[model samples]
Target: MYGIVLSRRDFREADQVITILTAEEGKREYIARGVKKIVSKNTSHLEPATLISFGIAEGKKEFSYLTNVQPVESFFHLRQSLPTLHIIGYSLDALFTMLKEGEADSDIYQLYISYLRFLNTQEQVRLLLLDAFLIKLFSHLGYHPSLDACVVCEKTYKEIGLEFLSATEQKPGFYFAGGGIICASCKAEKQRIGEVAYPCGIKEINTLRFLLASSWQDVVSFPLDEEEYRLVHKLIYEFMLYHSERKWDDWGKISLIMT
Candidate 1:
């Protein structure tokens, strides 16, 4: 089946344990023997984000053994920039963390392939693409945040007059525990009950909504300034962390890219 290599680790001698995400099988671990050797032709096909078609031999153990590997696409351009490479690495790490073994989701597989394709071609908005990818990934995993209205009271932003706020005073008025933006009425209730609410600014909120709702091609042309970029990044990252119940060690380093 065709799949993208997600991660790999050296095993005994020249063998390696490779983790791959496939369109049919989801995330899988395979034993690739002797691929680490210099003479091995499959070495390049096993790198992270390398798209390939391969067959596996079912084994008695949980992990299967790889048989034939034919390369399909390699994102060679990603190797040009350190920052871009790091973002791709983190994206793989996040995908690895969220996906469970043997869980196949074809949508996720397609999304991953699309992400790699975007990184390979687009040099300008890698970070924006990263943010959109995370949002879209979580959405496919059933953690899509409520963007149309308040998650708590179900009031639309227009109903609450959020659009009337000046640029300098726009606040996301988001409550994480509530799962999205908390309307003014719900915000007061949160305060009355002593719950902490974070502000995500109207511009940032609209930008996020746009990202989640827009197509990949549309997102490529979406306008974003430095501040909006940082805001959306922080919001999506935190939202993922809260929903996934996972922490990324390199988040600080990733955040530095936004600055």
Candidate 2:
């Protein structure tokens, strides 16, 4: 089976427990004995986030042994950029959390590899690769937002605004939690009933629309101004946090490293 190394950790004296996202199995764990030795044969071939082809010998229902492993792509460029590495870490964590053991998702594997290659570019464009990656990943996971039309009235979002509940006050700002835009009528209705307090503008609305509609390559090519980039980043991060219910702690260390 072919897989990408998702994570690895020490298990015993000379063994390491490794997790991989494979084409045959969605995600699986294996114990590679004697992997810590300096002269270990598989030591260089097994690296977190590298593409690898391996043969697995199933020992029990829960785990397996990595009998043979061949490196396919190391993504060496990602090592030089701390932010890109952090983004990859966050993405892999999200995938690992949602993926089920023994399930096959070949399409997801292909999408992942393609996205990674795109991310290795030298362009350094403003649209956060992390944000694009999350949106694309969610699309694959079937949680993609309905941006073609309004979530309330089902009308095309010709031009819409965004509302965000501030993280500090827990106040409902401007957002349509159901799917797409919350029309003026619905916004007024909610405010009349004391459901929300304030309004957030539509300056970034078109950018959101473009993001939802654009291809991955187009998104990477488009340049995002500072404000829009920051807004989109926050939105993607918030959406993921709300849906996954998982706190991402490593992000802070990653940010520090990048700075």
Candidate 3:
């Protein structure tokens, strides 16, 4: 079957437990025997974010064993850059955390493939794409964050003028559990009852909406400066962390790309 390697960890001796996302099987782990041995050909093919085709031998037990492997696309060029690697790392962490093993999701698979294709062809790493990918990925999993208006109120984004960093006393922020942007008033009330929001500016909100709703071709041209990039990165990274039940290791991946 065709699948993308999401992650892998060393098992006993030369073996590994490889987690892969397949269109036919969603995400599943297979025991890859002796991959650490020098003669093993499947070692490189199973790298995270790689598109590979492989055979499997399923037993009556809960796990399956990898029989053979042939990589379809390794995203060679994308892996060559540290920035792109961070993007791949964060994206895989999200997928590994959220995807249910043995469930099939062809749409999500196609979405990730398209993302890798774009990154593979680009010279510069557009982190906007990473933000959009996370947004879309969550949408597929039924967690699309409300971007246009307050989740608690009906106020439209156009009526809002305050930015989180500039405004005082509980400014607007992306309420992760609330699944959208909450107005300052609502945020103030939520704070009294013990809830916090991720600070965001007006421009950040607009860019987030644009990223969420627009196609890749259109989004690639939109401008994203360093400061805006940092904010969006923090917002999405934190959102992912919260939703993933704090399963991710920061690894300085987000901070690594900041420089």
The candidate that achieves the highest TM-score relative to the unseen native structure = 1
Can you give the TM-score per candidate against the true fold? Answer: 0.89, 0.80, 0.83
**Which candidate order results from sorting by TM-score in descending order?**
1, 3, 2
Query: Which ten residues in a row are the worst by lDDT in model 1?
Result: 163-172
Of 2 and 3, which scores higher on lDDT?
3
Model 3 per-residue lDDT tens digits across residues 1-259: 9999999999988899999899998999999988999999888999999999999998667768998799899989998888888888878988888888888999999999988888888777666767788878987888888887888886777555544445554357788879888888787777788887776767777777787778776667877777777777677778777777666664335554532
Q: TM-score of model 1 relative to the true fold?
A: 0.89
Off by over 4 Å in 1: 161-172, 249-259
True-vs-predicted CA distance for residue 245, candidate 3, Å: 1.1
lDDT of 1 by residue, 6-69 (tens): 9999998889999999978899889998897899999988999899999989878676889899
Q: What range of 10 consecutive residues in model 3 has the weakest lDDT sum?
A: 250-259
TM-score, structure 3 vs. true = 0.83
Candidate 3: segments with Cα more than 4 A from true spot: 161-171, 247-259
